[model samples]
Target: ARNAGIERATSEWIAFLDSDDYYWPEGLSTLRLVATLTGASIVCGMLSDADPGRLVPEELQVSIADQFLAVMAFRGVVPPLSMSSSAIRRDVVDTVGTFSRSHGTAEDREFWIRAAARFPVGIAFRPVAHYRIDHGHGKNDAHFASGAKLYVLRRIFREVIQNPVVEARLRSDPASDVFYRLHQSHLLCLDAAIRIRAGEMISAASTLSDAAVLCHTADELYCLIRELAYFLTFPRSDPYAATLRCSRWLVTLARETARSGDRRLTDALLVRASDAIYYTARQLRRSCGEQLAWRTVIAGLRVVPTIRSAKSFLRFLAESPRHTGHSLMYPRNQRG
Candidate 1:
């Protein structure tokens, strides 16, 4: 229906805005100027959350490969550009084809990836739209279930793998292999997150371990660690067991990083491992008593890092009480 509407329109350029999103007053003019200046088939602009922001660059051009890498690196939480913030040349659409309805939830993202593979894309580092986050009432409502989201994400990646242009680009670039692995790891981690939410702790842990094996870079490792933290802290039965497993992984990863000569990252991992153990101890203390919590921490210190002093242990002991009973590891209100 959307494609048919675009086809029937008489305009030389087309811009898309979702029903819940709105465009800035000068959005059309800005995109038109960018398209003309860069001779690009598609032009996208920066988006504001619910407020207008200043324009920094008049126009900027980004290669399709860079865009693809960025999306993969961020695990699709951040798209290369939002559909509502983009404008397309009519001719380019005629050549590259229209959006696919078969893609389920992420049809717009699929179309953008395909278009990017075939055309030059320009970006205006200026607000052209406001992406209204609809809180719990949005498409991402928890009632939808995470498994459905995982299926949609998997389907999108399968389409990417089948795309000739994207495959050809991957073949030409050796570094693309690493990016592809990271993308795969990200998908697995996402699946694990969903499983964790569903209280499938064993399955989630298995999937997360698989993702950890595929991680080769510091960024990938760090992201995996963060996801593990979230899983441990997520509201679930036997969260203490999950925390123990996560702390073990962190210690193992820290050892690996230390051997690889990344002392800074190793130190960070060790600190997080300690935190995880301390969090577990705090939980035990609340249910049982201070003696058991101290015992748990002392036992954990033997496997991971030892606390420098009793004061530091007391500090760790003090911190987790404040954050007890929270399901989310990170702030829910923060945008991806």
Candidate 2:
């Protein structure tokens, strides 16, 4: 299909977009300018998740070097492309061959991996497309079960480690480091989760050991570790409050990091934090009841930002002896 689309090209430049999105008035002009300046085979802009309401760009405009390094240390920046907002040079596509249909759900991410392997990539951080998010029947509703997530993680890891082209890309370039680390931590986290879920006690221990060896404790790897630790340490009935506390705090941390211009690290941090919240909520909600769980979630969300002050926040966090009964003794970690 991509071949057919390329073969019937109507112009020297061709752009890509999914059916559910719209191009902004500035998109073409921006693409042209980026193409002229970079002489790049591909040009990309931001993607908005909300309706003129919420604009989320595909490219974050922070320091690329820091972003790449952080991702290498941990899996950060796993998602980059907004298909509707990206433009590709005709010659580049023809030279590289079209997208393969075999990749399944991660087709876009896989394409970027292949493209970055071959040519110089460029990004434009301006909002170029609007991605309608709340469409009730949209494809975004897919349930990311623990089982499915495990499969995706394994495939990503296998591809990154075993593919010769990808390995070569990693060896020579600093820019590719983010993708490598981002995928690496992802695999480790998912592998750990799978072992625990499958009741493979020895296997889970082995994977966790390997993960520790690989330096997966970076902030990006924290959420996975937090989850794995929670599941392994706490009773099924008691994890929500603790999980909620961690999730709220982690999100606040990510936001602050992004605001501070360290978004690459923050991005990875956000994913780990997000996964922690998700699994915790899913596991607890079914057994413990959402209403009861949400009260704690709401309380944690309220207090996280205040914790930035540290001094007072620490006192407050430590006031309860154990925050949310999860044994979160924050002021203890902060004593100078």
Across residues 1-336, which tens digit of lDDT does each residue of candidate 2 receive?
555777798998888767657777677787677777777777776675434533443453411112223222243342245567777787766655577566445555556555656666456667777654323322322323224534653675566555555566678877555555556655665676566556564465455545544553455456445534433322222455445544544455455545556544455545555555444433333434444434443344344433332333343444432357433432232223
TM-score, candidate number 1 = 0.59
After the best TM-score superposition of candidate 2, give how far the Cα of residue 42 lies from its true spot, in angstroms.
1.6
lDDT tens digits by residue: candidate 1, 1-336: 668779788988888887657888787787787877778878887776534543343444432224555444333222257778888888867866778777556677677666765665776767678755332224543223434645675667666867776777678777877767876887787676666656565566566667777876666677656644543342223335556666666566556556656665566667777777776666555544455555556556666755542444667555644455322222233213
Once fitted onto the true fold, the runs of candidate 1 whose alpha carbons sit more than 4 angstroms away are 53-65, 73-79, 134-146, 220-336
Worst 10 residues of 2 by lDDT: 62-71
Q: Give the Cα-based TM-score of candidate 2 against the true structure.
A: 0.56
lDDT to native, each model: 0.62, 0.52
* Backbone clash tally (model 1): 0
